[model samples]
Every structure is written in C-alpha cells, then in structure tokens.
Target: MRALTHLRSLLGSILEKKGAAWPDKATIEPPKDKQFGDMACNVAMLTAGKLGMKPRDLAEVLKSELLAADPALSKVEVAGPGFLNVTFAPAFWQKTVEEVLEVKHCFGKFNLGRGRKVQVEFVSANPTGPLHIGHGRGAAVGDCVARILRAMDYEVSTEYYINDAGRQMRLLGESIWVRCLELLKKPVTYPEDWYKGEYIIDLARELLTLKGSALCDLPPAEGQDICYEYGMKSILDGIKKDLADFRVEHQVWFSEKSLVAAGAVERTLEDLKSRGLAYEDDGAAWMDTTRYGDDKNRVLRKSTGELTYFASDIAYHADKYARGFNTVVDIWGADHHGYVPRMKAAVQALGRDADDLKVILVQLVNLLRGGEQIAMSTRAGQFETLADVCAEVGVDAARFMFLSRKSDSHLDFDLDLVKQQSMDNPVYYVQYAHARICSLFAKAAERGVAMPECSPALLARLDTPEDLDLMRLMEQYPDTLANAAQTLSPHVVSFYLRELAGLLHRYYSANPVLAASDEDLMRARMLMLAAVAEVVRSGLELLGVSAPEKM
Candidate 1:
C-alpha cells in the first residue's frame, strides 16, 4: 500500500512538472504481462514528448523519484523504452490483500458518481407485443448501466419509458380484435395494414372469452380500439414479466401517450420557440438542428400539426433534465444512430447543454441456431421473443450471453453455444470456478481444517506465477469495475470474469490447495482462493448473472 501510494504521488508530481497541467487523473494500470513488472505506465512516455526529452531519460528520472519516495516497491526499473516497471514488496501484497478482505467487494470503489441523480431509460418497447431478442440486449445493457452507475455511487434511477402511444397500438388492437372475430366464425380478415402475428389470434380469443359477441359483430373501427387496449395491456404485462425474470425492474414506466394527453408536447414546443430554437416552415415547425451539427433541420410538428417521435423525445428529455439529472444517458438500438443528433439538439434547445445527453447505440443482435443466422419475421411472429430464449437457455444464461459482448458490437446469440454445459461456455466456466472454491472449502472442513489468519508462511508464501498472476489479476478487479462504470460497459466485467476463472482453473490444476506439508500453506492458498471467489461473485452480481457455489 505504501509503495502504490508513494508511486501515484511521485508520478503525479513528475507529470505536473512537465508543464501539461497535472495529469488530473492517471490510472497506474497493471501491465498486461507480469514479466514487464507488477504495474506499468506510459505516463513517462506521454510526458516525455511534451517535455521535449527522450522517454527513456524521463523514465529514469521518474524511476529514481519513485524509488526514493517508496523503498517498499522492492525495485523500480525501466524496461524497453520509457516503460516504468514497478514491483510490489512481497509483504506489500499480503498487507494490501488484508485491505481487500477488510473492504470486501467495496474495494477500489471511488466517488466517480458522487451521488449525482441520473436515470437510465431503456426497453421502452410498446406494450403491443412480447419482447424479442433485440429488446433483451437493450434491457441488459440499460439495466447494467444503471447498476454500474449506482455501484459507482450515483443516485441512479432506472426507468422503462413505455411507448404506449402511436398508431401501431391501434393497429395491433384492430388486428387482434379482427383475429378474434375471425376465430369466432365471423371470419373477419384484417385490414391490409393490420398485424398478422399469431399473438393477435390469442388476444382475440381472450377478448371473446371476456366480452363474448359483445365485441363481435361490431364495426372493425370500434373493435379495433377495444382490442387495441386489450392486446396492448396483455403484451405489456407479458413484457414486464419477461424483463422481471431477466432481473430488469423499472423505477418508473413513463408513458409515451401521457406526454401528449398531458399537453407536454405543446408546452415543450413553446419552450423551444421562446428560445428561438424552433419555428414554422412551410406549415411545419422545424427545430434548427443544424446548429447542433445535425445534417439538416428537423420537423418537430408536421405540416398536419401532429408531433413526431422527436417532439415527444424533446418533451421526455425536458422532463428528465427537470428531474434534476445533471446528465442523461439514453441507450438505444444502432438503427437509432441517425436520431442522436436531433435528440441532443432538442436537449440543448430546451436550454440545457446538448453534451449532457449521452446516447449509446447498441448494435442489433443476429440470433443464430447451429451456425446459420435465424432470420425472423415479426409480422408473422416467427421471431424469438426474449421469453422464448429464456425458456430455451434459461434466464441466467440468456442474460449473461447478452452482456458478454460490447453492446456496440452486433452479437450473435448462438442458441447452440448457450446451451452447451462445458468450458466452451464462459459463463459456466466462471460459475464453476466459484463452485470449485466451495468444493475445496468443503473438503477442507471435512478434514477439520480451519482458515488461517495471515501469517509468516502465508506472507512469504505466494511465489508461484499462478499465485502472483491471481494476485495481480485481483488487483485489477476494482479498477475494472470503475472503468466499466465509466464506460457503461458491464461486458468488461464479464471479460474479466473469464480471465479470473482462467487463473483460478490454471492455479487449481498447477497447485493443490490441500497440500501434504505446510498445513499453513494450504490455509493461505485457500484464503486467496476465497478472495478469488468473492471477486468473481461480486463481478458477476453487477452483470445480474449468478455466481453459483454449486454448478
């Protein structure tokens, strides 16, 4: 701890003197390879260019400064060119780990969020249908963002902005109602534009059971409205249940229809107009989005005077900012990338900073079976719903797979790999690592062994590459969490878990936790194994995945 403390300060001082306004926040990241040293920094190289000096020379100076500052580093050496190689005293590793045990999973936590009130609005799919796989990824990403923000110490609010409005719901209702009548021997064919999904038929049956011929023999227009309500509610309820099983719960379900019914759209338009950010053009109201770097200005209200999704978004964001959130993050599908500029323009036009709104576009998922993509037809309801995938691979595996990839990258949710119960499945491997530790601990207890406190043997004990590798890996866990929180990428933790499990499995195979000699060594190694378990479980928990103690 003293070594790391001194090194951070020394580096900060050296960088400040190089005339580039102190590297306000520079992370002393662990180098990818241990042979390079316990930790490595490009800070010297970074500052060397700014200082107009050779990087190697700069590193030499910093090395001396670090050594003088903290002798406990064991050795501070420069490797390659300008790479600052830092070594922790063996005792330093032991003591710092005591801190890990004391702090538990709370280790490496920072005041990054500082309790700022931020809300994540995601999976606002219309209640017109069950959630499909695409919707599942968004839910996982959005929910994880909220989870990370909260863990980073923010006053986070997670919301589900229900798209309960729009013509789609009406069409859905009409489709279901007609499908109902069609099933009842009324033989009603849907309008050319009505929904053709099988869900419509089921909804129609439910409506018939409750309303009987009361809804039958009626005009499609009347039945459309009634059935739209019926189908929408049914679908919405179904979506909520599906999401809840995936561990997604909303602090609020902000309604799309309410923005219009409550007159927020008109009020927001007026607010924009008052700020000279909006105006009428060719019988349409346009927001000067070009000012905010949009390709062209956008229509807020159509020539017909109906508000577009943009207008509702403006109102929605207005409400988000009004709720006292200094920053608002919107996670959306990649197809909505073109919509980002206009939304930010709206946020700014409402007298708030456009930069305050961060829109993350997660690319679409390509659901696959065997090795080929499974093309889906939403119209005929041939697409796999989130619920369907859950039923096939289970909620845990489904959610874990969705969170494994960078949300920006198009993920292929391979039905085959997810169902695999072997090392091929990374989630299973990580969970098994946790479970293996439990098995080892149980084995120890069966032999009347108890966990040992830190001792001279445990202190001098960890010398194996696997052992040090695990320690160094554990050290990165906190910063890993902080960085994941910073980028809103919970997948980083997923990736880290794989590496952690890899280390655990390798260590288990290379060395035995229950040894012949040195009973204290067994206890010491087991204590480290416990640390591995705790870290893996903590990381998995943030992603809403299970850290199984028994597979």
Candidate 2:
C-alpha cells in the first residue's frame, strides 16, 4: 500500500527541478527478454528528451536519486539503449506478497473511475429466439466489462437493450404461431424465411397451453402476427433462463417498445433537427455524420416515414446520457463494427460528447468439437447453450473457458478441453494450486504447526531468486488491473491467473514448507502463500468464477 518509494523520488528530482510533474505513467515492465532485470522502466529515457540530457546520463542521475530515496533497491543499472533495469531487495518483493494476503481477494481492485455512474449495454440479442453461441461470447465479455468497472469503484448499471419492437421480433411471433396452427391441424401458411428452429415448435406448445383453443378460431395467416408476438415473449423468457443459468444478470431490460411508445425516438429526431445535425433528404431523414468524421451520412428515418435502426439507436443513447452515466459502453458482435461510426456520430449529433460513450465489438465464437467447427444455430435449435455448457463442465470451467481469450479475437469453444477438467485446462490448473495450498494448511495444522505473522522485518528472510520472481509479479497486479480496464480486455486477468498459478505450483514443488520450524522462514513463506491465495481468489472473482478451497 506504500507508494512506490524510490522510483517516485528519482523521477520527482528530475521533473520538480525542471518545474514539471513526474511522468504520469512509470511502468514496471519485466525486461522484454527477462535478462534486463526483475523490473525495468524507461522513465529516465522518456524524460531525457524533455530535460535536454542524454538518456544514459539521466538514468545515472536517477539511479543515485533512487538509492538515496529508498534502500530497498539492491541495484539500479542503466542498460543499453537507455533502459533502467531495477533489482529490488528480496524483502521488498516478499512484503508485496504479504500485502496481497492482507488485502485477501480484494487485491488489485482499483477505484480508477471513482464513483462515476457508468452504463454497459451488452448482449441485447432480439427476444425472438434463444442466444446462439456467438451471443454467449458477447454476453461473457460485456458482463466482464461491467464487473471490472464496478471493481474499479464505478457505479455501473448492466443493461440489456431488448429489440422487442424490431422486424425480427415480428417474424419470430409469426413463426411460432404458424407452427402452433400446424400442431392444431388447422390451415396454416408459414413464411419462407420464418424461424425454422425446433425452439419455435416448442414455443408453439407453450402458447397452446396459455391460450388453448382460442387461437384455433383465428385465421391461420391472419393470426400469425399475434402468434409471433406470443412466441417472442416465450423465447425471451427462455433466453432469460439461459442467462440466469450462466450467472449473468442485468439491471434493466430496456425495450425498443418503450422507446417508440414514449415518443423518445421521434423526439430524438427533433432534437437533432434543433441542433442542425439532421435534415430531410430524398425521402429519408439523414444525419450529416460525415461532418463529425463518420465515413458518410446516416439515415434516421426512411422517406416512407418508417423509423430506421439508426433512429432508435439515437433515442437509446439519449436515454443513456439522460440517466446521468459518466460512461456508457455498448458491447456488440464483430459484424456490427460498421455501426460504430454512425452510433458515435448520433451521440455527438444529440449534443453529447462521443467520448462519453464507448463501444466494444467482440469477435465471433466458433464452437469446435475435436479440431473441426461445430455448427450451432439458435433458430434451428441446433447449437449448444450456455446452460448445456455449464451442466457439462461447470460454472468455473464455463466461465474460465469463456474468459481465456480476448474478446476481439475469435474463440474456438472446445467441449473436450473444458470437460476434461485436467491440468491442460487453465481453470483446473489455478484451482488445483489453490486446493494444494489448502491441503498444505490442513497438513500443517495436523502437525500442530501454526503459521506465524509476517513481521515488518520478516520479508528479509525471502532472499531466493524464485521468491523474488513471484514478488515481481505481485507488484504488477495493480498495473494488470489498470491495463485490463483501459484496454477493455478481461483476458488479461485470465493470463495473470495462469502466470501466478505457475509460480505457486513451481514454488510449492521445489521448496519444502515444513522442512523446518524456523519461525521467520515459515512466517515469510506462509505469508507468500497467503498472498498467492488472495491473488487467485481475487482474479477468479473478477471473472465471476468461484475459487474453492478444495478441488
């Protein structure tokens, strides 16, 4: 919890004398190739350009300044190309681990955004059908974004913008109703492009029970719209159940129906007109988004007077801003990438800063069995569900697998890897490390051995190279959290878990924790173990995965 000691002073000496501020970012990067040092920074070199001094010379000055500020520095060498490779004393690294223990699973949860209100709208898949595998990826990524922002002390509202008023919803209702009429042995006409998924047939069954024979009297083709509406609701209910089974929750299910009913969509168009960002053109209402750096103009309403998707989006974003969110994030699939420019333009057209709204587009998820791709279509009810995935593997395995890759990258969801529950699985590896630690504690207790407190001076006992390596990683956790937030990549936390788990597994295998009763040694190592526990626990929590004390 202590401020980064000597590095701050060294940088301060250079900047304060020059009547400036210390560089806002002083990263403690592992030497790119690892031979440079445990931690390295180019602050001195970064400042050299501003200070009118050679970078090497600046590093030399900063080295002396650093040692003077804190004796924790074992060595500070100015490497080639003006890099400052820093070696901290063994005790310094050890104490970092102990701090992790003290903080428990709360380690690395930062308040970067303070208490600002933020809204994350993701996985707004139309209520017309169940979520497909692709939707699952967005669901996980979007949910994690909200989780991380909340962890960083932001008041985040996780919402789902249901497209209940769209063409898709209407089509869905028709599909289900047509299927129901077919089941009732009545004359029916199904649309060629109607939903063909078995879920539609299942939804028809639900409607049969809800409305019974009353639907039999309505003309088949005529009542299809009503049936479609009924089906959309039934499908949405099923979608909610699937998401619930996956442990994902939303604060709001803001419907497009609400937008249209409240006149918000029309009102937004008027708002744009008042700002001169909109105009009537060629049977279409166009937004001059190119003026604001978009690729071209966007249509808000068709010349036919029907509202366009862009129009609804404008109203949606306006509602977001009106709700007073400091930040608004939209998570959409990769195919929606083209929509980003105009959406941002819409926010700006509505007179809100584009920067206030952020959009994250997650790439597709290709479900694979063996090495071959698995074809899953929710409309066909042919794909796997998150609920099915959870039941097959587990909540932890499902979550970890979903989180193991970057959102912007395509993920191959492998049932074999997730179901095996082996060391090859990263989730099991981390969990096993945690379980191993628990076993160690159980054994230690059985031996009538008690863990001693880490004295303020006990860190000095941790003087091994491996011990120092673990500490170096510990110091980077805060940066890891910040980097993940800034990049909107939750997979970084996934990477961190594997890295820390590797360290702990290696340390446990090589060292004998019970070799001696040396209180200082035992206390130091135990504290490090506790710190490892805290980090793994905190990391799993971020992904909404549980870290069990037992495997």
Go through the candidates in order and give the clash count of each.
1, 4
Off by over 4 Å in 2: 1-6, 18-28, 46-52, 219-222, 516-520
Native-to-model Cα distance after best TM-score fit, residue 71 in candidate 1, in Å:
2.9
Tens-digit lDDT track for model 1 on 1-551?
Answer: 23455567777876666665444344566677766678777777767777888989988988887777765677888878778888877766665556666777776666788998887888887787788999999999898888878888989888888887877776787778767777777765657677677887788788889998778777768877888788878888898899898899888988889888999989988988888889999999999989988899998989987778888889999998888998888989899988998887777777878878888788888999999999886767778899889999987788788889899998988899878879998778888999999999888889998877756457467766667778767877767877788777889988989998998898998898797357766777887887888888788788888877777
TM-score of model number 1: 0.94
Ten-residue segment with the worst summed lDDT in candidate 2?
A: 1-10
Predicted structure 2, TM vs. truth? 0.94
lDDT of 2 at 307: 90
Q: Each candidate: what lDDT?
A: 0.81, 0.80
Error of 2 at 348 (Å): 1.2
What digit string (tens of lDDT, one per residue) describes model 2 on residues 1-551?
23344465656765687765667665656677766666778787677878888989988987777777767777888988677887776767767866776777678877787898989898898887777767777887887877887888889999998898867777887788778878889877767677888778887887888888787688765567778777767778888888887778898999898899999999988978887889998988988899878999988888888898889988998998988987889998889999999888877777778988898888877777787888776666677766667777787787787789888788877878877757887888988887888888888889897877767688777778878777778777887788778778989998988999999999998877777458677767877787777787787888888888887
How much is 146 displaced in model 2, in angstroms?
Answer: 1.5
- Kindly report which residue stretches of model 1 are placed more than 4 angstroms away from their true locations once superposed: 1-6, 13-27, 42-58, 79-81, 187-189, 455-457
